[model samples]
Structures are given as C-alpha cells and as structure tokens.
Target: FDVTFVNKDNLPEYVWANSWGVSTRLMGALIMSHSDDNGLVLPPHLAPIQVVIVPIYKNAEQLKQISSHIEPILLQLKEMGISVKYDDADNRRPGFKFADYELKGVPVRLVVGARDIEKGTVEIMRRDTLEKSEAPLEGIAGHVKALLEEIQTHIYRKALAHRQEMTRTVDTYDEFKKEIEKGGFILAHWDGTTETELKIKEDTKATLRCIPLDGDTTPGVCMVTGRPSKQRVIFARNY
Candidate 1:
C-alpha cells in the first residue's frame, strides 16, 4: 500500500501513481519460522543483549558491594565484544525482571546476590534450555561467552528440527490432501502446469511455496495431473 499525491491538469486528470511493498509479510514469516512452546525465542546471535545480569541485594551496603564485584565482569564481557545488560531496576523484583527478559528472548541470564558474592559463584541461566547452573564467578567472562554461542546454535537447531518434523512428501493427490491438512511444507510431483496448481490451491487452500532448488529429482507422476515429472516441488499454506 502507498500514499501519494495525484496530479491533475487544469481541466482533467494528468497522472496516477501506485506503490507496493511486502515487508510485513516477511515479518510474519520470521515469526512463524521459529515456533516453540515456550514462546518467542529470537536467535542468540541476533539479540542485542545476549546476556542479562540481574543483581540481588537487600540493603545499600550489599548493593554497593555487588555493584563493585559485577563491574569487572561487565567490563570483561564488553572487552570480549559480548552484548550484556545489567538490569538494576530498583522497583521490580528479580522474578519480574527474569520473566520480562525471557519474554524478550535474552539468551543468557546471570543472577548475582549477596550469597553468590560470598560463595564466589554466580547463577547462570540459559534461555533456550531454561536451565540454571552455579558456576565460579572468577573468570566468568569466558563461560558466558561460550554459553551464548551454545544457545545460538541450540535455538537454530530447534527451529530446523521443527521444520524437519513438519515437512511431508506425498506421491499422489489423495496423499497430498492428507499430508497438507497437517499444515507444513509438502513435497510432491507437479505436472508443472499453472492450471493444476491453481486447481489444487482452490480445492485445498494450499499454494505452491516454491520449487525448491534442492528438491528431490526422482521420477514420479504428478500428484494432481498424474503426468511424468523429474522433481518434487514444495507446496504449503503460507501467510
């Protein structure tokens, strides 16, 4: 959609303009590409704050000491070029901040408290696995950096695994209907005609997503027209 000023001649219409962009559809595709039950989880490498550090304290002195102890770790992370955030919100409790960051998809969370400082350890939480482990605070920069990389790979694999599970290959039109109803990428032979493509779309509400560059080329009859074909194209219902 576009907004434009239409020009007019002295006594008649002179020019008309039209514009179009499909970026919102791209955003919708990204949102659906990674479907997880835990909610929205962005790729770790793409997130601004890969690690969020939340300080826990009761009194002013504890807060001061915790701040001092965390300074070196934060500086070390910065030097290593890791994106990190120290959430020191005065009003909200630690639990609230934890949920907020997870919803925002922070890959790792570091919880530091008076006990952690005394014990010389910090609680490290991974967003992908939602697992927490206590690790030594000394030289924590390396641990945090490695954890970020692991989470990055983990979420990506999770998305790939989901896509693999949802993908289906069908040999006949009947089989295509059964599989496509499950809602995912369907690989099937096409007679390669625009008419059959539109007919199947009108019948099943599934459209040709793409003729995958790496699609299977084994010989088979088209699912709709039963004509000889070389490769299986991908069909699916997409927004």
Candidate 2:
C-alpha cells in the first residue's frame, strides 16, 4: 500500500510512516470527544445530510402540495453544491424524525409545513447549537452554505483546543506518571533504545506515539534509564 510516486533519487533518507486502520474503537473516541447527555455533535464535513427538509401536512393532498412547492428549492440548493435530504416517511412523526436526524448528526434541519408554505418561510434548526430560526424560502441555499462552513470551522477549532489542552510536558518520571493517569499525550525525553521503550510500556502501558518531525536537538539524559538522549518523544496510551 506504500506506493512510491516520487523518483528514487528525490526520496528522503528516512521516510517514517504508520498506517492505522479505522475500527470500532474510533467510535469510542468520537463519542468521548463530541457526545453529551442529549446527543452527539457531528462535524459538518462528516454529516451525511447537510440539511434535512421535512414537509409537514395533515392530509395527502396537503403533503403533495407542500412537497411540490419545496421541490424547486431543494433542486436549487443541490445545484449550489449543498447536500440536502427530503424526509417524507409516513411511519415516523416530525418529532421522531427530528430526534433521529439529531442522532445521525445532520448539520441542519428545515421544517416546511402548511403554515410555513403560506408564510413563505421555513423553520431551520442547527444540530450543533440546537438553535432554531426562521429563514425565507428564497435565499436558503446561500444561507445554509454559510452556516455549514461556520459549523465545520467551529468543530475543528474545538477539537484542536481539546488536543492542545490534553498535551503535557514532563521532565520527571513522577510528573509523567501523574499526567499519564489523567489520560493525555505526554512529551518526555527517551534514551532512543528499544529496551528502555519496552520497559516503559511494561510498567506504564504508554508507548512512543511519534518522535516528531522537528524537535530541539539539545542533548539531555533519559528520564527512565538515565542514558544519554538526543531529543524528546511523544508518548501516550493511544486509541
């Protein structure tokens, strides 16, 4: 799977890489990072349905009329490069559909009912913030596009902040152990020996995740085995 696309002469001396396939364990990380008591808050880029359009009506004739009116709007949104879904399932009620879409992490939901049709507007609900607003039927495509971009950027910033807050730097074994118990990445010095690495794993259950592409070259002593060290390595109990 590691196909080299570059010329042999242009390759670097050490091309370090690791491939870890996604498994059910990734779901655990997702839930830990994004879920709350109410439900999961999905990143906008990962949501299957960017916007769910649910037309509410009492009778079949009313449902048909509402659907016909919303068809062109849906098509216009699609043409503008927005992912949209129409939920017209008869089995579930509107409340049930709302709950289901929220669980699946749809970024936005638009409810277009008989009343909304008369008012020339739609009820919009944001999954991440749970904020509801009324939007005019005409400019929904552009508004939704902007809202989705904002949600995507917000999720990335939140996740990056969590990663930064979890990272810890320790110069002593006692501090390393204490921080590792709190469950986060630990940056520490190592002697660059497989034997010491194995011993650390045997004792703390933490392994070197990466040596980092760019690190300080200042010489130091290893924290574990008291051997001469060159650079620090990031260690963690990985997912």
Candidate 3:
C-alpha cells in the first residue's frame, strides 16, 4: 500500500510513498537492461567474481613459472578487496576459459601468458565492450580499482541512456494510446485525479509509474481530459 509516513500523524495530506527496494524485478531489470547476444554484461559492482585470471603457457615449465609470477598479483588484488580468480584448470585451454568467463559475465579478465610474465605485464579484457589492452603489473592494484569504477559508471550511463531513448513524451491522448502500444515509459500531463489515472489505465493498460522527482514543471493540460495540469508524470506499461 502507498502510505506517506511510518505513522499517520507525520505526513502531509498529498504526499505518497510505497515500499521501494530490491525485489524479483531486479533480475528481470538487469537482464533486459544490459545482457546481449554474447551473454550477460554484468556491472562490476554486482558481479560475484569481478576479475578472472587465465594462465597461458606453451609447456609445463612455463605454466609453473607463470603461476609463481601471478601469485603475488592475485594477492595484491585480494588485498585491495577485489574479488579475483586464477583459472588454473588444466582441462580447459585459455581460449575456452576466456569464452567461459565472458559467458559468465566476469567484468574484468586478465590473460597471463608466458610472454606477459616475462614482460611483467598482463592482457586485460573488459567484458562490457570486449576491449582488451596490455597493462604492466606494477601498481596494478590502483589501476584495477579505477578500471572497475569506470566499468560501473559506463554500464550505468548506458542503461540510463537506453531508458531515456525508450521513453516517449506525448501531448495528446491519441498519441498516448499509440505510443503505449510500443511498451516503454511515457511522459505525459495528467489531470491530477485518480479517476483520470484509472480511466487511462482501463483504456490503454498504462499506469502512472511516477511523477518523476525531476519531472516537467511547465503548466499544461491533461492529455486525456484537457484539465489544467501543473506537471508531466511518468506513465508506463511496466511488468
């Protein structure tokens, strides 16, 4: 139920509220917002395993050496509170490991080949854009922390942009009915009456998702009833 305050005596008559937090919708939202044909494109902060390191070498001796070289690097990452995995399973090739982690949505991947160990570097790959770059292991702790933050911001911006693009601004009821069919957020003026809100939903199955915190404030008339409205509210056919 939408209630303004914890106690009935503490709220203004017009204020509205609801229980807002994580729910079953979170999984659906994440999948719809970010996942692609390649697989899930998880944001770094939410990934259970943020970094996966795959070791590549031509021989058992080099594999042993690479392991020794990367042990310190893994420890450094762990000390920085970065979740890391050294994928040392011998049954799978490095290429297979890469594809596996990419499918599993590890936000960051490091390929530590024999050459990289000799050169004191690692090949880092970002899952979001599938971009790879070589980075020296020196001061890797700080560099990785920054990269994770960048990935987080990048994904968030991309999702917000998608939402904005999906939204429609309508000034007429006919346009509302037609736009609602496409199924995204709708920005429209309403008559500030629950009767008009319910009627719109009955006719088009669209509901007022919210009067956006930063919604349009220009004086206008409701799209349905033409009654004077002070601002535009967000309407949507949400799941």
Candidate 4:
C-alpha cells in the first residue's frame, strides 16, 4: 500500500512519507558528542555566548582598570555580530566565573587582570582543547572571531575522527557479538528479511541502525544465515 496525499482536484498524488518531531534527545546528542570531563565543549556557531570575558582582579580599582581595557574589545566583538558576555560581577570570584562559563560551554574565554593590563596582553583559553595562550590587546576582537571559527572546525573534525575509530566492520556473527559488547557502530551484512532481523535482535539486542543511502553497495552474505545480501547496514545497541 502506498502512503501519500490527495490533490485538490480529487486525484491521488505521490509524496514522500516522512517522520519528524522535536525532542530533548537532540540536547542529549550534543552533550554526548562534544562534552568532556570538564563540561560541555560547544561549537562556537551553536553557542549562545560564543565568547566570555572574565576579569581577574583583587580590588575594585583593579577591576575598574581591567573593565576599561576590556570594554572596547567587548564592543568590537558585538559589532562583528559575535555573541559575547562580560562577567565583571563582584559577588562571584573570578575562579568561580571561569568554572561556570566553562561548564556552560562558552567556546572562547578571555581573562584580563592588572598584570595583563600592564603588559598590554590578555590570556585566552579555548574550551575545545582547554589550551591557554597570551595575546596582545591590540586587535584582540578580530583574533577572537577567528578563534571561534577555528574552535568550531576543530571540534567537528575531532568528533568525526572519534566516530571513525569506534566504527567496526565484521564478517561473522561471532565477531559482531564481540564488537557489539564494546559499544559503537557496527557494519555487517543481513539477509533482507524481517524474520532474520528479528532473530538477530533477539539474540544480540542490536538492531539495524540504518540502511545508509550512500556508500558501498557491494553484495555480501548475511553473517547469521549465510544467505545472499544486498549490502552492509549499520547495526548498534541503542541507549
């Protein structure tokens, strides 16, 4: 039976049947993909606050000077259409603010203190690698903009590499079972039948994740039944 729609002229029309919905599962996927032991490592493009400025100072006078120096850089970033936050509140300590913004997934963090002002430099940290470096105050805004773009690309490539490392190709049911226990994507052949799919699930608790629309389409034999198969499909244990 074909699933489709009816036209205004009372004629049956062909349309692609699709399923769509919004859920918090997307948030879960984001956290699982980029988060680390420290906290969330959000890509800059998706971050609400792509950059956060944390002022490190001992006294109000020191903060006043630091804020004076940081204000221009903050304005420049905002002018360039980059979302940024200047955290100079007196209640929270600078260390606490650093931890909070890091946990919240701000991609770039700039720390400016009395010494930095004297040296005409700011300490910058990127959440993706948690690497810190010093940069002169001159043209800091433009540097941060470029850093955000770099962070986004670096995290994406890192996640891609991780996925590739975790994925496995197996030609035997015994190898499939062992790989499934390790928990990642498994590419294996399955005879195109509902009974075979159900049998595999019953035995291993792994299901066909998807039949990729693109990729290798070479013929193979089902690992379980030794029957001819069209192509390999992604199989994995759902969480």
Report lDDT per candidate: 0.85, 0.84, 0.88, 0.91
Order of all candidates by lDDT, from best down to worst? 4, 3, 1, 2
The alpha-carbon deviation from the true structure for residue 197 of candidate 4, after best TM-score superposition, in angstroms, is: 1.3
By summed lDDT, the worst window of 10 consecutive residues in model 4 runs over 16-25
Ranking by TM-score: 4, 1, 3, 2
Cα lDDT tens digits for candidate 3, 71-181:
988999899999999998889888888888889889999888888877989889999899999899787767888999999999999999989999889999999999999
Best by TM-score: 4
Q: What are the runs in model 4 whose C-alpha is more than 4 Å off? A: 1-21
The local lDDT score (0 to 100) that residue 204 gets in candidate 4 is: 92
Residue-by-residue lDDT tens digits, candidate 2, 1-239: 45444557886454445555355667667767775565878776776678899989899998999999889988988897778999998899999999988888888899999999899899999887789999998888888889999888877788889888988888888788888888989989999999989988888899998888786567787888778889888999965
Tens digit per residue, CA lDDT, model 1, 107-224: 8899999999999999998887889999999989999888888887877787899888988888888888888888989999998899999999999999988887776888888888
- Give the distance in Å from residue 155's predicted Cα in candidate 3 to where it truly belongs: 0.8
Weakest 10 consecutive residues of candidate 2 by summed lDDT: 12-21
RMSD of each: 4.9, 6.2, 6.3, 4.7
At residue 152, candidate 3 shows an lDDT of: 93
